[model samples]
Target: MNKLIFLLFFAVTSCTTFSRYSPHNKMESCVEGYYCIVNDSLHLKYETLGGFYFANNLKEYRKIKVKNKPKFKNIIFYGKSNILDTDYYLILNNEIYPKNFYFKETVINNKKITIALNSNTNGTYNKDFILNFRLPK
Candidate 1:
């Protein structure tokens, strides 16, 4: 009887953590070198430092950790530039979506990294976003 009650409680709590509005499980499931921001029904993930850089979404909001987020930003093809190792410059681009509903470049401060991004998500909803995160030197 005691075991059954414990199991029931565990299951209920587990399901609650996966909810989109769940805040407790937000930082609880992040890996050592990654950070995540929960938006509406999307989980945008960023890495502190790694081989690849950029935040992306390809799955429903969940607490499970994926090895790497997809390549959402391409600074080389879109801007005709090179990406550096110290920082990341990204622009969200898509034509299928209407204006003001896709992705855009948020101003990145040079407190942590020193790179450039020639963002061109103009006339879209990409300019209304901003992300600020600092890594320890």
Candidate 2:
């Protein structure tokens, strides 16, 4: 009787957990150096970065790390101008096009990166929305 009850309980819990979060079981795409997930439901991509250097002074670079993991359904393309070690990077968000957003300040706390973007009057980003990004591992 004890064995029967234990098996029933285990089966019920396992079914509930699996039903709550359905698995995609889709294959991931790793072409060239970029990794992507494309299916009928969602699409996301990840690209390795070289660096983001200032055009005026190539000697200095913007210390920014691209998150290697994709958690949302968005098309992200991260790459440098050239394959050279001194290449610079530029991130473009398709949601907010026409106008561009620049990095005002960046804070690293508890292994997480929080980027504060400079206000662009012509941009579509709302002032109330806070942008938080995860660093590359």
Off by over 4 Å in 2: 3-9, 12-23, 28-31, 42-137
Instruction: Please state the error at residue 53 of candidate 1 in Å.
Output: 13
Worst 10 residues of 2 by lDDT: 16-25
Q: Estimate TM-scores for all models.
A: 0.19, 0.21
TM-score of 1: 0.19
Q: Please, what are the lDDT tens digits per residue for candidate 2 over residues 39-120?
A: 2222222122222222111112222224322111122122223323222122322232222333322322211112223334
lDDT of 1 at 71: 28
CA lDDT of each prediction against the hidden true structure: 0.29, 0.27
lDDT of the structure predicted as candidate 2: 0.27
* lDDT tens digits, residue span 1-137, model 1: 99999999999655421222223222222456444332232233332322223322223211122453322222211111122212223332312222323333333331121123224433222223222333322
Where is the poorest 10-residue window by lDDT in model 1?
Answer: 76-85
